[model samples]
Every structure is written in C-alpha cells, then in structure tokens.
Target: MECAAVSAPVSSHPPPSQINTSPEGKKPPEHLRRIIGEPPGPIVALLTRGVWALLTALSPAARDALARFVGNLAYTLGIRRKVALDNLAQAMPEKSEAERRAIARGAYITMARVVVESLPAGDRMTPDWDKQGIEGEEAWAALKAHVATGKGVLLATAHFGNWELVGQMLIRFGVPLNALVRPLKGALNTRIAENRLGAGAGLIYPKGAIQEITDAVNRGESAFMLLDQALPAKAAVFVPFFGRLASTTPAMAVAAERTGAPVFVVMGVRPPGPGARFRLEVEGPIPAPKPGEFADPITEHTARVTAALERAIRRHPEQWLWLHRRWKVQPPAALVTAPSPGLTSGPAPESAPKV
Candidate 1:
C-alpha cells in the first residue's frame, strides 16, 4: 500500500548561506604509489561482478542461507571478531557475555547479507512495496510533511540494516535523494556510482560536496549521508552514543541550520526469517536549535540526532555495523570536564522507549 498522499504548495527558495563543508583531508598526490598488497581496481571490479552474478542467480532464500554460512564462517575464524566483540562490550555492558556473543554472530550474518543485497544486480532484488514492505506511519508522515514544504530535507542515516535499500525505497515513494559517499578505489567507485544512478538516486562525493548539497536542498531535493562513522577530533563534535562520548560529524546539523532544512533519521530493517522483506523506519525533523537555545547549537543538534540513532540501534542491535571502532576518538580532558550545556555525559537509562 502507498503512503497517505501529502500536499503542500511549493515555496520560494531561501537565499543561500555560506556552506559548511565536511572536514575531509586533501587528496594524496597522484605520484604516490599504491600500497602493496592492494589489487588493481579493474580486477577487483571483475571479481565483484562475478560474485554478484552468482548471488543474483540464487533464490532469495538460498542467497540468505549462503550469507548465513559466510557469516558463521567469518565469526568462527575470528575475522575482525575481536573488534566487533569489543565494540559490543563497550556499547552494551549491561548484557551478559553470552548475549553479546549472540548479537555479534547475528551482526556478522547481517553484514554478509547487506554486502550481497547492496551489490548492483539489476532489478532482481528491487523491493516490491505492495507485497513485501512495512512503513512506520508516524515517521513516514513526518518525512512526507517535510518534503511537502518544498525545502529539501537532510537525511541522517547509519550503516545499520540495508542502508542502500532505503534510498531506493524513497525513490519508489517519489522522493528524490542525493547521497554523499566516500569514493572507493578505482573501477569499484565507478560501478557504485552507476548503481546508485541506475536506482534513481544522485551521487555527491565528499571532497567538494558541500556547495552541491546546499544547492540541491535549496532547490527542494533531499541529501542523504551516514552519520555513524568516526571523525578526527578536530573535525568532530563529542556526542553521547551508547553511553560513551563519541566523535560525530556535525555536517548535517550545520547544513540544516544554514539552509533551513529539517533533519530526519531513516533506516531499513530486515525482519527474521528467510527471504524477509525490509521495514523502513524514519525518525525526525529531529528538533532544531531555537534562537539562543544554547551556547553551541551545532553540538546540541548533533547530540540529538546521535541519540536518535542510538535508540534505533538499540531496537535491533544485531543489524548495526559493530565491526568498526565507533568510539576510537576521545575528547580532551578540558572539553570532557566542561561539557556543553544540554549535552548529557551519562549513559541513557535502559528504559528509554524504542523507536
């Protein structure tokens, strides 16, 4: 079934403000040599395409079974097992060791599934919303309302679930999206760009995407990016994530403040069972900073969105990408001692409502 139709008169574009750019470092010199052990891009692309072809030929159930097998193999062999387990321990210390291990195992399986699902395998895997889809009514309504205003939205998402599918789903629902992604090596990057375009979404690379993103939003188009990755201390704001202070990018908050766009957190979840359909969850127009609301509105806005993401992850802990070192960057003693107003230093109570 389709979402309830939302209608609003398109409004005039707001005057552009100085864009806030991401704190990405300069590119390395072209003369720099490729690191040893890295394969050529074309070879990697060919192998990737071969794997995709094999996976695509299987029925959805069979593909899921294969993914589970791979995930279990990886976990049993201790491939990045320590990293995932450590992240889980830090994030969910309340859980018993056995419980955390189970979550990690599930995470590995989900990660494998995500890799296969994200591949560019033509239309075989495109979601048929009418037959196999569930939407969060309140969150969907909020997204439609924001889009109705004709001011493009800033979508803050994470690596949780099948994030690539979320964009495709939105396109099906008539929302145009441009996602900011870090370029991969060689032909792999080109393949991904083609896949995103093939799925009806636009691409914005991070090196110089600020101006392009700003223009797109002002023209009433949404921009999407992952807000769950770690950033260097200088380019990040300390925010509470999983009961610890983690470095988070403030790009979405800055863009929203400058362009008068609302921010929303969207994710896609795969339910239990073989060949399960995806459930799309949206949360926000996360409260923006009012005039003189705090000493550092950017920090406050970043924290609010981060908290929303944490809640989403808690709901389906197994679906999140726990393999990465999410809390690698720490704040200095001075900033930790003098935390920003309205930003909590303690972990969230266990009873917080799930998204």
Candidate 2:
C-alpha cells in the first residue's frame, strides 16, 4: 500500500507499528534518532550558557574574522568544498570562468563568517531588517498583515544564509517565533541553543515539534522552519534545485496542509558591511492545495523556495553555507552534474573574482 503523499512526519513518539515488532525490525538511522527528542535540558542549558559567554567575550570584528578563518580552514581540509563548488557551478553556469571561481571564494569566506557570527554571545544584536534593502518588500508586508488576523504565520526557510539570525531578528521585533531545529551533539549544540534562546527565540525538535507548532498556530503563533537538508531515510521527495534533484522536506507543506496556515518563504542574506548586517526577505502566502489536488503542495512549495534560494545565493554567493552536503544523494545519470565552462567544479580556482 502507498503511504500518504507526505507521510506522518517522523516524530519522536513511538508508533503502534513498532509495538508488534521485534528488535530485528528496522531501526531508524543514528542521525534521525539522535534528533528525535526535545530541546536540551537544564544541564545542557548550563553548558550552552557557558559557550555563549565565551563567544560573547569576543569583539564583533573578532567573531566575524574567526568565522572567516574557519570557513577557509574547512576549504583547506576539503570539507564539503566539492558540494559547495558543485552547487555554485550549477547556479551560475553562465558566468566567466574567473567569475565563477571568485564567487566560490567569496562563498567560502561568507560561509565561515556566517558560522562564526552564529556562535553564542552573551547578547544578540537587533538590526533593523529594513536597512538590509530586501527586494521583495510586498511579500513581507502581506505576511505582517496576517499578524492582525491572529492566525500564526509559518516562515519556511532553508540552510541558505544565517538562518538562526532570522529567528533572532523576529524575536527582537517581539514576534513570537519557535524555530524547528535539529540538536547538535555535545557541548557545541548546547551553547548555540542557549544563545539563541537568550536572544528571544524558542527551539523545538522535529520529534515532538509538530504538535507544539500546530497548537501555537491554532492559538495564533508564528513559526519558522529550515527545509533544506537531505534526510535519505525519512520520508522525503526529490525536488529540482540548481537543475539537480535535491531531497526536499515535506514538513512545510504538511504543516500548511494540516493547519490551513498561510506559508511564507523567508530567508536572510548577509549585507556588504564592516560587520554582519542581514536582509530578511519574505515571499508568498505560498499557494496551498485547493479542494482536490492529489499530489502534495509541498513539492510545489519546495520548488518555489528552492528557486528563491538559488536566486539569493547567486546574488550573494559569499553569504551562503557551502560546507553542508546539500546534494549528498545524487540522482540518476540523466541529471546534470558535470561542470560547464566558466563554471568549474569544486571550490574557486584560487584567483576568481567575487560575484
């Protein structure tokens, strides 16, 4: 029998199907199981606080530079550089060879700076998002209008730019938002969580988060989702990204489908400045399913979001995270992969001009 288009998301609650099974039955992958729980507890909270304190001690310049250092170091060590470069090549195949390479280098620098800037700090800065010069102001304006209706809004995002900072920005504006995030293992995760929470954003794990988000929306709360990861085991469908099939999460679609809540594809892009300035762009009351469409709107919703993400990355290649294995699972040979002229494979060829 076929499962629901968007199968009940892999929540933390044990399924009845598991009750009759023996140990021999398939176990969830370690990564899925690891994040299948709630946010860190008090001990975890304490650790997070300490980490944030350490990060907070650093000056803004130091923090930004440190992130740049890590990004370069990661490239040197070949961490996700292939995937980053590959993804970049796909996005801007028309650029000159040098231009493509420059974008890659800028991307690395941006990735590293973004990471460092996300570190836990004693206090989080509240930047006026309007100053960032978002291109699509009408979309965001419409979303804000929904706030008056008292219906909670869902801002679906991806691993594109400084996403966590998006949550921080909303919180600073006093917009109550709960960000759905996977827990990082050990001390590092704890610290980041603490800093984020301190910055006025709430965190929920995928396991039990559905219920929480649903209830919040029912009671008029806004939520944020980052839907740009490849979860091979869980129920995910392929969607075109950079002309390649990338595993897109159906959670945003499911959430919208179930709640009848209007969905907006919002993302944060880094601005050109001395320190970290960001532009938050919100797009659409993402068209939802009508009376009788059989296929999931998630695939469509994901497609739209992916297109937006690609555009954003193209505009600011340096600000996106190139280290994440976004296209880890390659599709059939028919799909595109080879590097086109001007768009060489892998990290920037060392002397390319930034886009």
Candidate 3:
C-alpha cells in the first residue's frame, strides 16, 4: 500500500541499550516494552488488521455496541485510565466525581468508534459529506469562504471525537488538506497511516517540514494539526489547558502570526446514532496575535487556542480523546502565575459570526 512520504524517524538510530523505548521518556520493562516500546510482532499485526476488517463488516448497531464495550474495557484495563481520570478532574473540577469518571470512560468509547470506522484510502468525497457531515451551517459557510480566499488555512483540532475522520470527510468533499502528522513507530500505527494517506489526504511530517507546510498554506493549501498532545520541554511552552498548565507548541499561533493566515478550529464529532454519521464542525477563527495582549505573542496566541479547545471540549464532554496525556508536561513553578498586571487572559477575539 502507498504511504505518505514522512521524514525519517525524528531521532538517529538509538544505541542497543535504548532499542525499545517509549516516546514517554523512560524505557518500560522487557515485556511491557513489547506492548509500548517495541514494534508489534507479526502475529499481533495480523490480528490488528483482521480486527479492522471485521469491524468494518459489522452492522452499525453491532459496531455501536462494541464501541461502548471496548471503551469501558480499556478503562477497566487501566490503559492510561489514571492519567485520563486525572486530566478530567483537573480540567473540569466543577463536575461531580462520577461525571468525570463517565466522561473518562466514554472517551475510550469514542476511541473505539474512531479505530473501527474511519474512512479509508480512495474513499470518494460526495455530496453526503457537505450535507450530512456538517454540524453548523454558519461555521461551514465560513470555512468554505476561508478556503476560497486562497489564504492558507491552519486548523488546530485536538484528538477529540473522530479527528481522523475530520480530514477524511474534508478530503472527500474536495478540500485539499495536508495534515502535520507524526507517523507512529510500530506496525499497527504504520498501517493506520497508510489508510489515512489512502483517503487522499496529504501528510506533512511534523519533525522537519514546517517550512514546506507553511509555504503550502500560504499558497492556499489547507493544513491540520493536533493541538492537544504533549511536546518536548524545550520545544513547547506551558499554557493553561483544562485548568492546568500544558506544554503547547506555538506552531499554529506562530504560523498565523507569520503569514497572516486565518486559523480555524474544527472537529468531526460522532452524534448519538446507530448509523455511520459524523457532525463535521468548523468552529470560529482564532484571531491573529497582537502586541497588547501579553508580553509574548506566542503565549497569548497559544493560550487563546487552548481556551478555544477547552470550550469545544466542554460543549460535548464525552467526545474528546481523554486518554491522551495532554497535560503531561507541567510548567515550571516560576512561570505558573497569574496574568501580567494589565493584561486580561482569555480567548482571542472572535470575528462577528458571519458566513
């Protein structure tokens, strides 16, 4: 199968001592490494493929039932459950403990739906995408107009809802989307990449293709990136996310500041249904950074993006990909303080909601 051309693995080949390493820093024990650090064995890879195919074949009702079962199962298995629960608690302190737990487990269910049903390569974009796929009419009209301007679009979407499908649905609808993706290390993730590429979406490797991607956007080519994942300490700045400081990449903000391109936030949420349906949403644009907002343009812009994301997550509490360790990198105690004296902290000014 054809795969999107990604940059070479970010790091040079590791020494033998660090052969099987988790991206999370430390190495897991020998057996655990096989699950997290090392690539899956052939048998496991084969099983994964079989499952993917089987899931596609199942009826929508069956798939829905399985989605719930798998989501709860993952939580019960504690596959990053603690981190998810912690994030939910910290982000939504006002909610009851039981509500947080339900949201946490429901996130897994969303994951299961994503894994089983995302569109594959060569899936044609049809009128159905522009019709049933959209959730907000004005948001959709704004997005179409933004694309028409040939002024690059940089969409900062989280690992929320059916994010992979967001790209697929857009691609299928004849939108040119080149996503900044970090290809996974193992067999399962690699195959997943292959399917995404097949769906007619372009891939921009995150490690070294910033300039190329920026140029593409400037030329009217749209790009998407996940804004709710961890980044290296040296690269990301801590921004308030879900009430705590999360190390955020200033890429979207930086790009918007540099090119004067419009930044849009989007999501493909799975509405409650027993059919294959997704509400592809185009949220309002994040205003370009300005000098008066704060001492640093990057922080001001990124914090606005983070707040926008928080608002989206709040709208549908269970649709987010909660298992991700979004707040893994905390800010230094020195940097964790209230906003500077005169600068009020909040979301960037949204333009009048015009189509």
How accurate locally, in lDDT, is each candidate?
Answer: 0.69, 0.59, 0.63
Model 3 per-residue lDDT tens digits across residues 5-91? 111121233233322111212221222112112456888888777766776567667877877788778889999998888888887
Error of 3 at 159 (Å): 1.0
- Candidate 1 lands at a TM-score of 0.83
Instruction: Report the number of the highest-lDDT candidate.
Output: 1
List model 1 lDDT by residue over 164-246, tens digit each.
76665565554666777664545444544555665656666555567767887876668888888888999999988887888
Ranking by TM-score: 1, 3, 2
Give the candidate number with the greatest TM-score.
1
Which 10-residue window in model 1 sums to the lowest lDDT? 18-27
What residue runs in model 2 are displaced by over 4 Å at the alpha carbon? 1-54, 126-130, 330-355
Q: What does the lDDT read for residue 63 in candidate 3?
A: 71
Which residue ranges in model 1 land beyond 4 Å of their true spot?
A: 1-40, 124-136, 186-190, 345-355
Candidate 1 residue pairs in clash (backbone atoms < 3 Å):
none
The RMSD (Cα, Å) of candidate 1 is 9.0
